[model samples]
Target: LLLDIVRLKGSHSAEHIRNTTEQILDHLSINDKVYKIITDNGSSMIKAYKFGLSVSDQNFEDEEANDEDSMDVDEQIGY
Candidate 1:
């Protein structure tokens, strides 16, 4: 269900739109409640969702590395 709406002025770049959407998601979905987002097929929305929960490319890379590390640990544990 739609819970809230926000209006923005000026140009809406992908990064800007992502920040605003994330802010709303932050207020609405906490403690890992957020899973997926659905939006119009606008290029800006597509790009914004691509950013995921990471604020920077470096953070995304770090997450990838951590995930790989966890997989290695799992393999060692006979999982």
Candidate 2:
């Protein structure tokens, strides 16, 4: 069982969610490749990601995302 916990402030839109998720995935890929990633019931994240939730598969995998290195500019400025 592997999981990457993402702490998001307030809420997000679908486009915003995709952008954020992509950033995390890109960072994670630097260390190790992942078969899939998962997130909770947040509307934006859930709708934007293809591999959201459902960790019942045999191929479930995880890799830590270096969020500190690639922070979201919009989020930092309160967008």
Candidate 3:
């Protein structure tokens, strides 16, 4: 689900976007729930996920791969 959208009036440099995205993730308390953040093929988005969000595109950065699958199944059944 689309939970939030942050709009800025100033320039959106990579560093700025990274910081903003991190803060938003922290504020929402959904950091662990996030796996992959689908975004446009923009450098800022890629950098935000890599450097700022610190998440890999292919993996969820978690030790247990099954944890995410379990979470997905749980969410599907309204657990």
Tens-place lDDT per residue, model 2, 11-34, is: 677777766666776777632344
Q: Give stretches of model 1 more than 4 Å off.
A: 29-31, 54-79
TM-score of 1: 0.56
RMSD of each: 7.1, 14.7, 7.0
Q: How would you encode candidate 3's per-residue C-alpha lDDT over 1-79 as one tens digit per residue?
A: 7767889557777777767766777899977566656778788777766743455554554536678888999999999
Candidate 1 lDDT tens digits, 39-67: 89899888888746534556556768999
Error of 3 at 72 (Å): 17
Q: Which pairs of residues clash in candidate 2, taking residues 3 or more apart in a chain or in different chains?
A: none
Clashes of 1: 0
The collision pairs in model 1 are none
Can you give the TM-score per candidate against the true fold? Answer: 0.56, 0.39, 0.55
Model 1, position 3: C-alpha lDDT score: 52
Q: In lDDT terms, how accurate is model 2?
A: 0.57
lDDT (0 to 1) per candidate: 0.74, 0.57, 0.70
